[model samples]
Target: MSDEELSSYLPHQGDRIRLRVHVRKEEETPRTKKNKLLTVLQEKLEAARKKKTTSKEEHNLEDMRNPHRPFGNRNAAKQNRMIEIGWIHKSNQRSTQIRKNKGGGTRKTEIPRHATKVEIIQQAIGLFFPNGLSSKGPLTNFNFDLWDFADREIDANVTVADMYERTKLPILRFYLATSQKTNDIGNTTDA
Candidate 1:
């Protein structure tokens, strides 16, 4: 029988088509998949951006209706405080002395202003714990509770040592005498 006659007798149209053809199919690589994903993401992002721009007027109207939204001015107070603190200078010797008496230095001396923050902190730490950092004998225990109290009063999120560096507060130096003590005591004791 001819091929046509045989094909016509088949039950289904697909089964009648017996011719086979070979075609090369390319496999998708990771790089190609990644590029496709990136393109899709970019398209989605552009759509979102356009949507946001189109709705901006609506958002503006809402903001106008409720000018004093709690979320709108969340950082306003903190920003103002930061600005106020930034305006403060280390040259205010009288203020520094007062702060020093309170056990918190908030300014640096003119010469120490050029020093690094770490240096200032180390100096303050040395002054506060003269016997804690040394390698000698007869270590003396000093109370750091005053420094903590001063830090809280300053309310600048800065360490007592750092306050001394910035304000050149003489009170910090009063507590910073050089001692002939050893670190062994400090290492063994928990503060």
Candidate 2:
């Protein structure tokens, strides 16, 4: 091809080819709690810088926002306060008649942090014993108690937060047990 034909095929850079560019400007202020926390931290960081404090314990806003960082996001504190728990159907010689009343499979639930063992047992009774603890059938002579995974009887006064603090486990498993009520002579009675 001749130079004249090549020049016609390729246009010069001086041609009027117009293009539009768009830019977006976000609002300068942030109103959320996280942003407020970041602002506070930034202020503290600035103050520390002015004082020439050591950089070993100092963390930037990005580090504070990271979930993987244990000390910054408040997850550890929240995690230590709550626990997921479930109930299992446990049977003994006295509870054999009520064996068929085992409601369903273990359904794990997150109970309130301040819930006590008695409250948990009541809630579990509602779930595991839908027919109610009637005074006519197998429930007549027996009372229900909650037992932990280690087969230890749980105290009714302890809270779920206390259990979480003591066990330090995210999930705590418990079982329902029936104990026969006694009369004046400490002997089991069916009255």
Candidate 3:
């Protein structure tokens, strides 16, 4: 087989795995709290406006004419204060790409370094088992509670099945072994 064909037949390389993780922007606060603070600020501004209008003769109308000036210094100051207090958080929509390095450490591309091995493993498991253990009867019997602990404890190179095997967890081992046998039998029958 040609190199291209051989490469296609082989399993995907580890470098190909890229996981996106949400990270809060620097100097930004939480969205909900920020919105709330903004609302309060708006109310205060309106109340001040009303008071100014009522006492227009006493104070100059120049400052009240444009509360938000062309440069918006007042608005900017409010935003800065909101960030300082964590009332408004950075946008989490922009995700950072996390790739696992050969040595097992993760490489985060872009800002907000945030992906961990456990998070990546959990994401991979979610992708692998989209419907969770509901569809797989044997898997339902297997202990899934160990996933988080296993992800942390096991070596990065080891496959989930291999990790389960290493644990000598009877339910998981039996399920996987039997499943393999069933697949083998099915293949033979098809042939």
Candidate 4:
């Protein structure tokens, strides 16, 4: 499949497909422990697919409306929070949406898909042999969780960098705190 088609299957199709999916080798994001965790999650989701409880989130017209608060009420009344639980097509428009609203920061390319009555895609790939990849058959079975693990690790690194930039911490302080023997900051999940 072309990159466009491949990119379209991000979360899974079939408004009912849980947040789970798999990988073989090529389609797999990367080789890492984080990806492994994601693959495990996808497998678990697949297992639960029989129950149909792991399905995606469906959207309603009311979800698009803005919340309105009545007089003397601190919290606004909303029909329902828009919880995107399904796959939506990706595009450049999504990234610049925040810019249109006059918000700061980088463009958020990835937006949660709005679940509605529509067709979805299902594809899988492995760290070695990604599903739907333009290649010969005989795709290998791999621990899909590696993809998740790698993604998480990448996010973690990105988070750390964002923290450093946002917190504006001094280089000396960061190294000193991170090098503590007893505290062993590298073992810490904290930034």
Per-prediction backbone clash count: 9, 0, 5, 35
Worst 10-residue lDDT window for candidate 3 reads 81-90
lDDT of 2 by residue, 1-191 (tens): 44455457545533212111111122446467998899999999999886665453354655767857657436335633434334443333433223333444455666677778887787766666567544333455657788776768899888777776688775676666656676789777653
* Candidate 1 local lDDT, residue 133: 41
Question: What is model 1's C-alpha RMSD?
Answer: 16.3
- At residue 191, candidate 3 shows an lDDT of 9
The most accurate candidate by TM-score is: 2
* Residues 92-154, model 4: lDDT tens digits: 223111121222112112111221111111111211123422122232211111011112211
Specify the poorest-scoring 10-residue window by lDDT in model 1: 80-89
How many angstroms is residue 35 displaced in model 4 relative to the true structure, after the best TM-score fit? Answer: 0.6
lDDT of 1 by residue, 107-191 (tens): 3322232333334445555433345542222234322212222332233245434555466544442222222222665442322
lDDT of 3 at 72: 35
- Cα error, candidate 2, residue 76 (Å): 5.7
Model 1 misplacement above 4 A = 1-35, 63-96, 100-191
**What is the C-alpha local distance difference test score of each model?**
0.40, 0.59, 0.33, 0.27
Q: How far does residue 177 in candidate 4 sit from its true spot (Å)?
A: 74
Off by over 4 Å in 2: 1-59, 62-104, 133-141, 180-191
Error of 1 at 33 (Å): 2.8
